[model samples]
Target: MILRAFLFLIVVWTLPAMGPWQDCEGAKACDLDGRSYHIRVPDDWDGDTALPVLLHFHGWGRQGDLIVKHQRISGHTRRRGVLLIAPNGRGRTWDFWDQGSADVPFAAAVIEDVAKRFPIDRDQIFVSGYSYGAAMAWRFACENGDGVTGLLAVSGTLRQTERCPQAPKHIRHVHGFADTVMDFPMGAGGDVTHPVALWRKALGCAAGRRLPEWQVVSFLSFERWHWDNCEGGHTVTLDLHSGGHFIPHGWIGWQLDQLMGRVPLYP
Candidate 1:
């Protein structure tokens, strides 16, 4: 009995510790500029093809691992065979308010590292965010247009761009009409309409066309707008939901569809 107990204790002592730093199976933990991030590869991946990668930013007061563990975005990513990466922000919030912020370089570094370590499709790189992260996504999309193929923004508006981007990008902005947190017609950092207008102008859209209304769910109505005559085949879509102050259940799926060129008239 003493011999058996000794062996068991030895085995337990040699086992690796399960901690917050440990990533789940098929996921990796990465650090850049003293910040940490979590990268998850779809379990269903064929292990041969170069898959698209999505960099999803968390809202204020949230960490990358929390988002990876709790957010429904991962489900859509897995179904679509896309690699999902969640980055931690400085001080539990993104630093988009600063020019040439550390977050920018950290974002670039994460992409660089992920591309080097995984089978990333450079052309299909996407960035998405919620709330404060959403604002940061817009900023990155505007400034790093060459690196990111598209942007998925929710529950936040962006600051004005300093200059026009060299390439036009596809952007989908979704928000609730009754949101009190970020509030419709956004109070601080500019209203919701500003970024849409900037994107239209930056994309060189000659005109804006409103699409027909589609009711997504009970008590949830939607209105969409498309920018016409954008350069580089780029387009922008705005989805206004009747629900408020929360990420809609279907929004992530809709975003994946849009990125895959499977956008439906009603989503």
Candidate 2:
């Protein structure tokens, strides 16, 4: 009952903040659907206090090396020592919109398995994915947001949310305005990642209006405007002038920083 009340208070806090540091490169096993994942830890772990984690999920592709390499998440982990986890979904698609309660348990399993080795900061855990993977992350946030600090989903749309959980006080999202697969204004035309505007409304941050758009001309055009604070603090949409249905290479670290509550990035 105490745990329940604590979580209740957490949800009611309105505007809140802040998880652990762990060795993602260590010998570990992540079990899902009777399948166990053999993983490797990074070589540069300095054994610091528990750190924040970035749960990176690949879209429909079988392997995610290209997205992982181009996006350059290791750079952020190298500087901040944040634990980065990459999980492969069963079959070609995630069980996101089942409406039958499948992805929630699978998500919990993944986190639990990761925690067995690394000291995972529950409040600081984050989720990110591409295409179908992004769709799953958004769905996860709606259905089982209790497991994450925030979400950084790229190029996807929203679907089947009656089973989706509430948006926590500590949350954020992103999408390309021109995304053909998951159009920007949301609904009908796009991937159903949720209308970016409406998605931002759910965060209800008090700090956003306090800060204005201070960043300069960013390479990811769409990322520039939406991510930059407009009238309100929430920035779940992007204009993506010339961009397409891919995660722009330049913006991965910045999004990760947002997940860590504006921690300064290292050079």
Candidate 3:
């Protein structure tokens, strides 16, 4: 008994201490290795149910904390019963321009860590971002989209790249016709529709057909297009607004509804 106790003590001393796991309450920040992310659960969540998750990335010069506090984002996630996760970029920005970026591994780590602590529906995982962060989302979807359900990108597109190994199951891209930061149509970065074109080519998607105008607000409307007939039952959509570089009101909510199948993809 004495020898057994000594051996047990030695084994215990050799084992590393468990790391902190943040709970999904009030958008608390969770740490994984040296990086950080924030998560929030719906108020009505029963704590045991496997809920859908939206992994949103913040734009350049922003952190995950700001995304959790944004009412437009957090409020919608709460109402939809979807868990929200916002990962902080390395040095306040993502390395999306590089093909071999560390951000990809960091993003994977964030998702894995969140799943370890929360009852997340892996099949319902969605990735989204804004501006530069949107570019990062595009990169992720291109490189690591095997298990992701969909991608909702706003006010940004992918950088110049020659290869995309995998295509996301679904893609919805929203941009402004008058956007100057990322520019409309094409800019210094590249064509805003570059990723869509790539997906179309990869999936052998039919030529895009214009959808009806979707009036979101009294003064704002979107001219939409959709490529429904594609290989592997994939989908691609693009929404162009008259506003500048910004996420329009009701935009995220409407996309979430479509993703959740509460609303049809087209009008």
TM-score of each: 0.81, 0.67, 0.85
> Model 1: per-residue lDDT, tens digit, 1-267?
999999999877654332233343234457666777887766556555788988888899987876665446776676677888898887899887655767877887888877766668988888888888887777777667666787888888665544545432688888887888876654357544454776777777767777997654466667887774687787888888777877776677676776778853222
Per-residue lDDT, model 3, residue 112, is: 92
TM-score, candidate number 2: 0.67
Per-residue accuracy of model 2 over 201-254 as CA lDDT, tens digit each: 454322222223333235544423333333333244332335567765535566
Over the stretch 56-148, how does candidate 3's per-residue lDDT look in tens digits? 989999988888877767777878878899999988999887678889889988999888877789989989999998889988888888788
lDDT value, candidate 3, whole model:
0.81
Q: List clash counts for every candidate, in order.
A: 0, 23, 0
Q: Over 4 Å off in model 3, which ranges?
A: 1-27, 187-195, 264-267
User: Residue 54 deviation, candidate 2, in Å?
Assistant: 1.2
- Candidate of highest lDDT: 3
lDDT of 2: 0.55
Error of 1 at 34 (Å): 2.1
| Angstrom error at residue 210, model 2 | 13
Candidate 3's TM-score: 0.85
Q: Candidate 1: where are CA atoms >4 Å away?
A: 1-28, 160-168, 186-195, 215-219, 263-267
Cα lDDT of candidate 1 equals 0.72
Local distance difference test values of all predictions, in order = 0.72, 0.55, 0.81
lDDT head-to-head 1 vs 2, winner: 1
